[model samples]
Target: MRYNKEDLIEWIIRERQPGGQMFERFTERARKVIVQAQEEARKLNQNYIGTEHLLLGLI
Candidate 1:
């Protein structure tokens, strides 16, 4: 399975277990991580954003 930006966003939201309208708060951090991951991949000249790239961003 491919882990794209949307998938990551959905995963984060799902994992948050947010209450009521609090889910929205997770969006910003999720987006930031996505953007940073993309940038890291770009800097490394990666053609696809894979799970390894996402893990790299986490570090």
Candidate 2:
């Protein structure tokens, strides 16, 4: 279940396609948050990114 950057971008596009430009904007924000979470996890010596991290970003 390894996800690359393009995979994430595609997922975001698909998830927000219905909302058009607004959804696109949201997706961009979400992606930034996800990246930040990944960086923070790395800083904490985490080997994998988990659902909890993603959930935290969403919140």
Candidate 3:
């Protein structure tokens, strides 16, 4: 599988939908950290950015 910017953006949008699923507001730095996690997942040939990637990005 391959990861790309467009796909990642779509995933992020889906993850942030209404109804209290995952609609928490994020700061600019938080958004950047999410993007970085996505990049790291892609670099490692993974399709999704899991907890480990997010933690690594935040650290």
Candidate 3 Cα misplacement greater than 4 A, ranges: 1-24
Model 1: how far residue 46 lies from native, Å: 1.0
lDDT of 2 by residue, 13-45 (tens): 876443345435566677666766666667779
lDDT agreement of model 3 with the native: 0.74
Candidates 1 and 3 compared: the better one by TM-score is 3
Order of models, best lDDT first: 3, 1, 2
Off by over 4 Å in 1: 1-26
Give per-residue CA lDDT, model 3, range 1-59, as digits (tens).
88999999988888754222352577667777787787788889998879988987897
Task: Give lDDT: candidate 3, residue 48.
Answer: 81
Better of 1 and 3 by lDDT: 3
Q: Model 1, 1-59: lDDT tens per residue?
A: 76799988887777644232443565666656665677788899987768877787677
Among the numbered candidates, top lDDT falls to 3
Q: After superposition, how far is residue 17 of candidate 2 from its true place, in Å?
A: 23
Question: What is the lDDT, from 0 to 100, of the residue 52 in candidate 1?
Answer: 78
